[model samples]
Target: MRPVDGMRVDVLEYCRVLASQLRLAGLPESRVRVVVQDVLAHVEATGEDPVEAFGQPTDYAAQWARPPGVLRVLGLMVATAVAFPGFWLVLTAFTSPVPWGGAVRVTPFLVSAVAGAAVVGGVYPWTVGLWLERRAGRRVGRGRSPLDAVVAVLTWAVLIVLTLVVVQRVLGPDGDGRTLFSVPRRVLLAVGHGGMALSFVLPSPGVQTMPRSPADHRSWWARVRSLLAGTGNRRRF
Candidate 1:
């Protein structure tokens, strides 16, 4: 949290807030950095307080914000939800000893996986944005507390238990659901592998390429420490 040379503490704070706001506005890290650096350079040249120069960080960022489209968000969520079932289909195709033409019943576990993926896809973005927003407002030099970790773990555990309970209740002891369609095992295998390969080549929606950095060569522990300390290259301002 120490300010870089020639950067005041308040100016550093302003940069942090601006970066956070830009990220919350759905700007990629690279774009956020470019904007933040421009602001920093302006403040440095004029020797003006950032808030005085640019107004509130949130308001300033709103000018540049391009919120993702509803269709794009929904598409991402559907893609995420399908990934689990796709993986399961591939695994089952490989392992099942049943005849190639046999029908595969949709099970409760599959249903649960889809439901979990949908929930996660819908909630994860907002949760992360809120977490980062809160962190940005915290006093400089303060890191995440142990209680935050505990609460996060507990929340996930509760969600998992509840999902399993509900799935079990609805699906009963047999955990069976109606058969949707039948396909040959060979066809399933081919489709599954093709889907997996396509997933690797496909560009994820809303993701922007990150610029290369020296930190990419650092050890995992070093990277973890930098992240925990909030002292990455992007934070130098």
Candidate 2:
């Protein structure tokens, strides 16, 4: 049977539209382009229309599955955990002790907070990428994929720095001798984080989740572990 005019219009064009929507949702434009191109290629090779091909998934349960790429999610979780500690320090900054036995008369709480943020900004994405690849039943590429890592690191870092700025303002001014540090100190931290983040905007492996092969056999341990992992966990998030 001949395909309809809509189907013949070109699958790549449809992919382009979808990629644009993904970009609007805040995904990196370059990464979206790559994903669109790959998906379009796959569809073309199968000689199937996108809507018809993906219309009914065989594994509906796996669609929302949270296993496999759990590491990526865990990085975000750790970053959240670090934020809590920073919050505690900020709330108690006035009573918080100065560093190195009071040699520096500054808000120790804010310093601790920035340090915690640095940890989140630097390492979160690499771990997340590893987890994502595992979830897709694929081997994660080693060494720094660099681009996606930069994106993940920078996004979290900027968020952390911005949070610290607000916290600092809430703690009061440096001239009053109550702040953890001066505005200049905070500015330097923000600059460092921003520079690190800009390094991650390029498309790299482990950022996009790919479908796993259904025919692949799982070991008994793998099957058991998979069962323990929740099938779907992101509907609310």
- If scored against the real structure, what TM-score would every candidate get? 0.49, 0.29
The collision pairs in model 2 are 65-231, 68-135, 69-131, 69-135, 72-128, 107-180, 150-200, 151-200
lDDT of 1 by residue, 27-144 (tens): 7766777787778779889987676677666567777885445665555445554543456567877776676677554456656664664455334434543454444334333434
Best by TM-score: 1
Candidate 2 residue-wise lDDT, 162-232, digit = tens: 76666666665545456444433333334444444543442222334332233335665775576578642
Residue-level error in angstroms, candidate 2, position 81: 15
Error of 2 at 132 (Å): 3.5
How does residue 97 of candidate 1 score in lDDT?
A: 62
lDDT of model 1 at residue 86? Answer: 57
- Taking every candidate in turn, the Cα RMSD to the unseen true structure, in Å, is 8.6, 15.5
